[model samples]
Target: MATDPYADPKLEGVSIRSLPKVSLHDHLDGALRPQTIIELADEIGLDVPSTDAEELADWFEDQSDSGSLVEYLKTFDLTTAVMQSADGLRRVAKEFVEDLAADGVIYGEVRWAPEQHLGGGLSLEEAVEAVQEGIEEGEDAVDRSGRDIRVGQLITAMRHADRSLEIARLAVAFRGRGAVGFDIAGAEDGFPPSRHRAAFDYLASEFFPVTVHAGEAAGLDSIRSAILDGRALRLGHGVRIAEDLEVVQQQGDSVLVTFGDLARWVRDREIPLELSPSSNLQTGAIAAWGKNLEDHPFDLLYQLGFAVTVNVDNRTMSRTSLTRELALLAETFDYRLEDLEAFQLNAAAGAFLSVEEREELIELIGEGFDA
Candidate 1:
């Protein structure tokens, strides 16, 4: 077994990084480049911790690993500060997709709250358009490089705010233009999805796909509201749903577990768990289980038949990639290539893409694994 967590391990003589992957819970503002942040900050007359790219990267890693949500969120304050301008948002979005493409991601959904970008005086529509322009540029760049990538926007609303209804409308309006889904983020503890009922009701009427950030900063009640009120097609993190499970007995490799109603509903319905292993550990989302990856309950979730998908929620903050996430899981659980492929299949099935497009993704994943 490899002692290095970041090193890629061969799964049947094929590197996991080379496998086609789908990212369902990655954040846009959370994946900024260090050099880009320094330059953008300079242009806007804002101060940054380090002007040198490498040092700035180290600064981010240190702050995020500080074990404080407040400290971790301060990094985004710097990133979003630079993203207040149209050019900045466009450049960041473009580079975001390009980086993912280089990292071997074939399909990804970049989620960010547009309401956070309007401090620069751009309307939500203009902000959305700027991001769309950048996404198209990145897609074109990937195509020119003989690689193909497709990324969609998951327009997000801040759960602590009251603009979800408007944000939902914006997301649905741009459905075909780049936006594929709706989500609510920020301060998941006090603000449950019930606060955004109007928005959820409107989205349900419009048939827009929704995902809510639950089970990270809160518990089962929050997740219940996310489903009942937000009509979430997917649960962001959703790790706490495991709390509802009662492990009755353990017999070596086999155990008898009883599930609560919510747990049963989510599992039986195959609602995807957008689990970001490293991020969950950093945010203390899985702290109840244990501190290390081995204690994550991720293996249990997988074995229990949850549609669990691996992700890097924030690459910059987590100092991780999809490859690193998979590598860590494999090292912890001794998973094989088939286990990794199962996660990809779950993500492909849960993607907001049409049935035909999703089938194409499934076929592509199967082919990649076969090769």
Candidate 2:
């Protein structure tokens, strides 16, 4: 029972780190420990910015705070570079689960593009197999430690790439193995989900679950395509869906707002928004609102009854964990423990799991919060 390094001071006499959480948008490549990157790079002859993990961690944070989605994405080059082998992918994935468990995550969905990891002469199937092996190993390790955690894969396809159809097939092929859903990530501005319609169509035909990276780097149009074309069950960092809302008036905690068709539909439909406050600030997703965490539309979305689930889109890059994210939001929005519980319950309801499994997660979250 090692103490969680990311634990925040108790809020309402409850340690945020000890609460059950469901991570819906965590990325495998983006969640690697800085020290692991150093050792992995050493093995593969890859050069990193700094051998010192602390310095490398700072470097990631500095680089990610560039306030441009494209600029923020450049940091992934180093992370993805080290994940180009079976062993590297396996190790990273294993540690990813272990770290989540340490942070009190009851369940998580680790997203990564298999196509990006093929540089080590491993095929798509091999890369997935390696990651699955790592996830299982991590889960077993967690069980042995007197804790329980389950993780699933969200096999991602790079939006700018032409092999989404191939990647989609790979995701569906891994169903019941490790993969639980599909997503199209990277460069969401120009490479709309419509561009990957063929893949989405195929996934839809198979009744496979889908989530798309939209409304973060882009706006309403991107979100529209994600739902209409990509058929996303959830929006990855869909914070910008706020752009569709026009604040007509405001007074203290009360405000009058007008929602456009897109925003209205998304909210009314209860399509979960995987809103990562830190990552949104770092990547300029909420630049239109303001430059600080309080400026995020997360509170607004939640108040408006949208299924707002907090997440750490990239743990290492943002230097964040779910606990830290929750602490920040609670501090900023003056949220109570029940608000935190609501977010976790939203995430559980939106998980890419069967109704029974989702209910179980919901029950676990409720019990943990009650304790």
Winning candidate number (lDDT): 2
Note the clash tally of each candidate: 0, 0
lDDT of 2 by residue, 21-65 (tens): 999999999999999999999998889999999889999999999
Task: Give the number of colliding residue pairs in candidate 1.
Answer: 0
Structure candidate 2, residue pairs in collision: none
Model 1, span 228-311: residue lDDT tens:
999899999999899999889988879789999999999999999999988888878887888888989898889999999999
Q: What are the RMSDs of all candidates, in order?
A: 2.1, 1.9
TM-score leader: 2
TM-score of each: 0.97, 0.98
